[model samples]
Target: MAISFYKYQGTGNDFVMVDNRKLAFPASDESFIKRLCDRRIGIGADGLILLQDHADYDFEMVYFNADGRLGSMCGNGARCTVRFARALGVIEDVACFLAADGEHQASVERDLIQLKMNEVKGVEQIGEDYFLNTGSPHYIRFVDDVENLDVYEEGRAIRYNDRFKAEGTNVNFVQRLSDSEVFVRTYERGVEDETLSCGTGVTAAALVAGMLGMQSPIKVKTLGGNLEVAFEQVDEGFKSIYLIGPAKQVFTGSVSL
Candidate 1:
């Protein structure tokens, strides 16, 4: 069978998107999904996203890592899925969608998407580093020089450490550029490599920065491009958190399954 797919990218976090509202895709085939995301042999994406029908929301986002496993809530993938939903006329400017983490609200203007993440109640400080879940687990380490760090090696160490080796976690290295701006690079677990960008990781880093007395509406610079995270610090945690960035369609094609 020939399946039509769209390629989308937010920053440099790219995904292979399929409109699976009809449930035609074989989602249970992990090897096929892995092949689809293989850079050398397939569609070459950081992950794959399925847009399916949802009874209570605009749509349902089903995400899979490049390794073909069902992944946690992927922020950039969600943003790209929202853009795909808009392209399919499933939503207008505003949308509410169901993801792995639960319900989420977002708005899209042209290619820019502002996605509302889940409320975080706490941040765990592991030494000087921090750990948090912003729809996804992330380990945030404030560094001195982000541009020259060995993200793959250092992030792999923490991600595969004794405490986090089982389920795994995304690792982020952040360097504060100013009071409101920081540079970040991430090593995502599912992808098992240093990706150009990571939305959930960026959000986690921003919240940690806020806890360290930086500010809200933090500007983030990544290897792929730039993104912004805005939130309100509540008494218990953070609320009204928004991950703002641009998600654009790279191309569209049909491939045999």
Candidate 2:
């Protein structure tokens, strides 16, 4: 069957989107979904997203990793879905939806998207790295120079290490460039390699640094582009955390799967 799909990217993290409002698409076949995300012979993407109907929100975002397993909330994927929703008239300029993590809010203004991520409690410092879940689980560590570091080598060690072996976590290497600016490199688990960008990874990285005494409105530079995370910190947790960057439509087409 030919599946109508739309491709979109938030920074460099790309996704193949399908409007599955009728829920007619097969959601149970892992191999089928996995093959659809294959770069060599399929409509390549970091993930696949289904825009389904929601009872109380604009729409529902169902995310599947490249491995064909349903995953926790994906920030870049969410932004792409929001933009897709707007293009489909599910929303006009603003939208809210329920993800695996919980409720999320986003707005589209002039092609750029500002997504409000879930509140992060804080980062737990274990040894040298900080652990936190910003919609998705991430391990944030600061290094001297992030650009030169071997992200795939070092990140794989920490991700596959015995401590996080059951379900590996995404790893991020961050280097603070200034009080409010930092460079980030990530080793994503689903893609299982270093992509040009990662939204949840950056969100976790910024929150971890902010909790550790860095300032808010943090600027994060990724291989794809720059993203800004702004928030207010309180004794309870980090609130009003906003992930802002460009979420653009790459192309739209139908693929036979």
Candidate 3:
């Protein structure tokens, strides 16, 4: 069988995208998906995304890490999926879709995408770091020299630590650049290494930084590119959270399986 796929990247976090609305792709074939995301021999992406039919929303986003396991709500992946949906004519400028984290809303203009994230009830402060779930678990720590930090070594330590070993977690090493900007590096759990960028990780980083007195619409710089996070803090929790970035199609091809 020859499966047609599209490649997309948001802030350097790339994905192999499939329009599976007709349910043609085999969702249970873990090895096949893993091979497609393998950097050495396959499509070479950080993850894979499926745009499927949804009864209540514009579409359903099924995401998988490079390891072939179902992953949590991937911020960048979702943004890419939304753009994919738009290219497929499933949506116009604004859209609402279903993901592993639940329903999410998004808007696309040109190559830029703005996604509405879930509300965060609280942020846990562990030692000097902060732990939060912005549709995905993230461990955030502020550092001084982010440019030279060993993200893989340091992030792996906390990601696989006994405290978070059960489910594991994405790790972010951040350095404050200004009141509204910061530099972030991430080690994603499912990817199991340092990635060029991480959407959920940055969202958590920005939120934690905001809680620490940074302003809304925080700008985050990553190795891949830059992203912005904006939110409104309510009395009970945080709301109107948005993750903004660029998601562009890299290429498209057919792979024989």
Count clashes in each candidate, considering only residues at least 3 apart in sequence or on different chains.
Answer: 0, 0, 0
- The digit string of per-residue lDDT tens for model 1 on 1-257 reads 99999999999999999999999999999999999999999999999999999899999999999999999999999999999999999999999999999999999977689999999998899999999999899999999999999999999999999999999999999999998999999999989999999999999999999998988899999999999999999988999999999999999999898
**Order of the predicted models by TM-score, top scorer first:** 1, 3, 2
Q: What are the per-residue Cα lDDT tens digits for candidate 2 across 1-257?
A: 87798888888998989999988778888887888888897888988999999899989999999989998888889988988999999999999898999899999988678999988886778899888889888999999999899999999998999988788899999999999899999998877888888999999998888887899899999998889999899897888999988888888898765
Arranged by lDDT, best first: 1, 3, 2
Worst 10 residues of 1 by lDDT: 108-117
Pick the TM-score winner.
1
CA deviation > 4 Å runs, candidate 3: none
Question: Candidate 3, residues 129-208: lDDT per residue as tens digits?
Answer: 99899999999999999999999999999988999989999999999999899999999998999999999999999988
Model 1 earns a TM-score of 0.99
TM-score-best of 2 and 3: 3
lDDT of each: 0.96, 0.89, 0.94
- TM-scores for all candidates: the values are 0.99, 0.97, 0.98
